[model samples]
Target: MGARELTIVLLSAPTDCVDDDRTEQSLGLAYIASTLQAHGYSVEVIELTGLRSSELATALHRIPAVDVYGLTCYSTNYHSVRQIVTHLRSHHPGAYLCLGGPHPTALPTATLEDLQIDSVVVGDGELAFLSIVDALKRGRRILGAVGAIAPNDLDDLPFPNRHLVDQKTFTRTLNHCRTLSLISSRGCRHRCLHCNSVVMGGARKRVKFRSTGNIISEIRELKKMGYGALRFSDDNFADNPDLANLLSAIAKEDILYRVFSRLEQLEPATVQRLADSGCKLISVGLESLNPKNLRFLGKAGMLHCLKNLEHTERHGITVRASFMVGLPYDTDASIQHFFEKASRLPFTEYAIYALLPYPGTPLWENPERYGYEIVDADFTHYVQMGVGRQTAFVLKHTDPETGFTFHPADVLRWHCLAHDLFSSKRHMSNSQVG
Candidate 1:
């Protein structure tokens, strides 16, 4: 048989952290792999989402000889990506290695220069990746990266290949396995000071969307394969203009799923439609309870989320929300107010994270302006967990004027406190409302 041109790709992170085994599947890799396969190149997606630290090097070695290696990662995981890329290069000296995703897109030059990386893709990787492969096949001498162009007509792109996830290694929700993640749109309309969406693209957001027909086709295929749900991973799920039609189609099928949404966008009619359409959970960003902090995070006020939460609960929709512990707008009092008020909200599930000054965000660019000192400058300390292991680097912050310091440990304590406050349901499994 003739030699086949194969490319190995990954959607991964360092497996050093605890709970890494239960991480979610990388939908991004599936999309890119499908693109490469559509172009007639053999593709293999090597996911490290739930593997041991020692398994990464061995896994790369075992893959059949391939022409290129591709990876997508967050800034926190880039440290381990470096180690794997080194292993890939050492094993296959001629293979072209490239990096993409939030971290590489934001810092392409540095990411390429710091390691044995051959190139980096700065934006949406579907076409950019195929282009890179063509260039590599032609054997053309290349520079560092190819900039991004947001695909305006999403339906034109091929469906993401879920076969790459033929094995189940990622986290499950409501007893479902990696039930296909669908990105209905790209870029966000809001310009939250902390969000990196604008930096990845431009402030214009370009908000492109897929047609309802296209999404329905994939949902049908999933249901036929015994998959019962879909996770809509859109940055702004509600903003899609075709949402009503999309929901209608989803209802036609018996699919149960969830999404990230703006609580403010939900009116009575929309929430009612979602409930009837088999909506199981909605994960909203409840950044803070303070009106001032809410506005700072690019929200109008707290009333919208509060009102919407009540509306969702009445419809039997479970709400899972998240709050940031240490926004620059967060004073000690405001942080306390967040936890205190959160326990009273309609949501039963919650997550708490210390603020991250990731590369492309305004907070990361100008920490002092936000009243944060960033006592730790290393990017490796950027995960929701930390580097080396979970909770390794305590991100220190100062009030600047009051000399008050916030330790990373304090963030953990508040999370524990929040959980304890909700111990009745989470710890005890008592779902009865007294």
Candidate 2:
């Protein structure tokens, strides 16, 4: 078959949760789909989140026979992808199966061996995926890892294929406004031990920013599509050196948005400028409150985060503060201190999660050095919430200073408590806003 004559179905596997609101659109697959379509190939993007295995199977049966099936893999969705791959192999035995995304990118050889599938696309998928399609069309035997030649010019890539998804189903609703997600930059500036950014960016750490004009043009395109609000899905918004100019350009466009940034990135002046640019919310990862734990996680100190929270509050922008429980050095007192400090904070929203040592992260590679024992290496249990929230990974050492022995169940115990507190606080915050 010729490249243009081939049909490709790009899909994301089902997540543990059936909750639609919690899931975001798969922009990675959307970008890959767009890249494929631009080269004159027939492409279909499927969102399988919030579906049971049986339901997913039923949905897959509905899709017409295609030449290739590309599945986006992540640690949380590893098993789900396996289910889809199994069904495809049983039904469409002739189809070429491909896996991409973080999980496969991190462990391509394992994903290939464990799943017994055909080919894994590492790093960027656009150019590499095109190469895969072209090679397959030529009847070339492609196996193992398909090397990626990532686009150095972000402007050269096409906008994500948003048309494949239903806007109402895919877009996020924040503070009574419908918001769509977009990325203005690739990679992140920080080197947080648990972060997958560095791993996903390949060995050496780096950050790449799309030109301000390119980003503004995409925003205008989104606005024309009836989206009044947006969510910046960049790993770190403030990491861009031209942030001020970018914010100024977005201000003239008159669009409200939310962004994720390091706590240290927000200053009084930057907060004011963000508010002026119609920023309704700022999401900061205040991973830990304890200085010792902060140092271990390679995060900024608590003082900076607190100051940033105050600045956002002063600017009337809601701040969603996310915290991680069960760090390497965490103790009963330290965990309590985290919640106690969180209760007194000025942020409008709270998100609490257990620390999952995702593959390709420094923490995952050297868990023993950080006082953790990998009791469960199963990718399904690697998820932070829902189905497999409780897993085998546990703390192995007692805090020498506190003489507190950490139990296996303490991680889930602390996470549940923090989650309860977060839920109650969110309810109260919503009640007050209402």
Candidate 3:
């Protein structure tokens, strides 16, 4: 098999148009491709965002015969992955099919039950992907094996093969600068109940960073290629203390960028440093304002987060705060309180999504306990737009008193509408300022 030329194809599922306006490339799959290339495999990474299931089938039919096919998916994309697997089995029966990323890692047994997926690469796919390719070449067993790879060892992995991504598609979808999504680390240190990162990667919270020199070098290369800004896709940028140093180093090189952070992690000094370092925007996960809801969601540092919102805005960085509604304890009054608080905050952009219970999260593991009733089994509906659990609500009829009731879908839709309105307002304000 080593003597023969191998054509490996990596596929990302189509994005739901209702989710958001921003387009994101499959940076995770890109990392997998990079790893395979380092281990001597020829690979092609494809984005299925704009393609229908049938289109994907047709495209798979036209591609040159490949030795291996790798796919990435989240809970919202499981159905698409299943459909692709079925098509691949019917058309390219000889091609080895492997599944990775959040959904597969969370539901490995269920995924294997399909029989279309030859193997499931659990946790980080970098080392496992390379090992599978190598083993396949040697006619070794590679299915149903768990790769207990550590996140701290991420520095050993090669940078993502950006050349495989469609540059025009990325530019058009993101609708911003000519940018590349970069991951400086893996695994979140905080325990967000609804997040699957800890469940898949483990709770030890291992973090990795590209060396300061390495990051700067990559930025320089992108700058030479006429790229404008970078989208740092790390789960929590401020989780690492050296982030300031990294920002300083990039600033020294005059590199422009954007990044995501947990609101609680921001400090005035750090916010100022980030702005000074050419950061045009910062996204913060402001999941909820209700203290009980926040506690239920396992969010730490609620007060710090509120303060950080003000601090970041004062520093002149565009703050994009993401909020969630329709949790188990959410009430109409509580949600209204959230909206009022959000209006007063300095966040220039707002992303409001319904509480989605994905397969692997703690919430999904024990939904009944959280007063949530599972409604949809289809993975496509698992997108933030789909209503998951019928949340039991507790409301406050007056500001001084708290009351209780239940109406899940309505609560979810209200939050979605609020998000849309805020987003539209933010965009208009930005345009006006420009």
Candidate 4:
């Protein structure tokens, strides 16, 4: 059969959510699907979200039989992907199966063995995946896996195929307007121990940005599609050196958006520019108020967080501050002190998460070097929330100078305490505004 005659399915494993309300599809899988379609190949993008394992087979049964299956895997969804591949192999033995994403990239050989798949693609999968399709079309069987080469120019790639999923039905919202996610960059400049961005971004420790013209063109396309708001999915949207020009371009387009930042980049002028560009919100990772904890995580100090909140407040933009609860040297006393100081901040929303040393991250590879000991290595418990069953695995203090560490129960308690504190604060603030 010609390559165009073969059916290709790019399946995305269900995302982990606090609730089953996710409507947006995986942008990464969409890119691969779009790439395949661009090459005049038949491609179908299937995204599964918030479905239990028992429901997976039923969902798979609904999909038409395809010649190729490519599944996206992450640590949180590893087991689900395994179940999916098992079912696929049993049902369609002749199909070509492949796995890719952060989890598989971290342990490609093990993933291939565990899932019993044909091959795995590590790192950026756009070009590598297209190459795999080309090879298969030439009737070559791939055995183990191939390392993906990062694209030097992100602009050369086609925009994610949003048509594969219902973009208008996406439930993500900002300022009461439906928001769709978009990425203008790849990689990060920071080397936070708890983050795996550097691992997935390959050996490069620097950020790569799409040209301002390319990004604006995509925004215009989204706007024409009736999307009023966008969520910039970059590691740190403000990290782009051409941010000023990009912001100016976005302002001319007259669209609403939100972005994640480290707060250190949010100077008074930058914050004002962001506000002027219709930026309604900024999410900052204010990991901790203690300088020692900040240093441990390789994050900016509390001063940055305070300054970020001050500038955003002045510019009329909301700040959603996220904090980590169970870091090295975090004791009950120190946590309470953080609560006291954080309560006085002007952030509009708060989220408290536990520290998880994900596989392939600096912390997971060398816990002792960072004054912590991994008590649990289960990938299922590597989530961010500290108050739920999906909370991060327990980490113990290994350094004598650290003084205190979070016990498993303490982690939950701290998360609950912070949640309640901030919940009440938000309520009171809303009341005063009303």
**Evaluated with lDDT, which candidate comes out highest?**
4
Q: Write the per-residue lDDT of candidate 2 for residues 84-114, one digit (tens) a residue.
A: 8988888888888999998888888888998
Writing each residue's lDDT as its tens digit, candidate 4 over 158-239 gives 9988888766545677777777889999889888878889678865766789999999999988888888788998889998
Off by over 4 Å in 4: 1-4, 15-17, 21-23, 301-305, 386-390, 402-405, 427-434
Q: Write out the backbone clash pairs for model 2.
A: none
Ranking by TM-score: 4, 2, 1, 3
Q: Candidate 1 or 3, higher lDDT?
A: 1
Runs in model 2 lying further than 4 Å from the true structure: 2-4, 387-404, 416-424, 427-434
Off by over 4 Å in 3: 1-3, 16-22, 172-176, 200-204, 385-405, 416-434
Q: What overall lDDT goes with each candidate model?
A: 0.70, 0.77, 0.69, 0.79
TM-score of each: 0.89, 0.92, 0.88, 0.93
**Residue 90 lDDT in model 2?**
83
* All-Cα superposition RMSD per candidate: 3.6, 2.8, 4.3, 2.9
After superposing candidate 1 on the true structure, give the runs of residues whose Cα lies further than 4 Å from its correct spot.
1-14, 21-24, 175-178, 199-204, 329-332, 385-405, 424-434
> Which ten-residue region of model 2 has the weakest summed lDDT?
425-434
- Model 2, TM vs. native: 0.92
Best by TM-score: 4
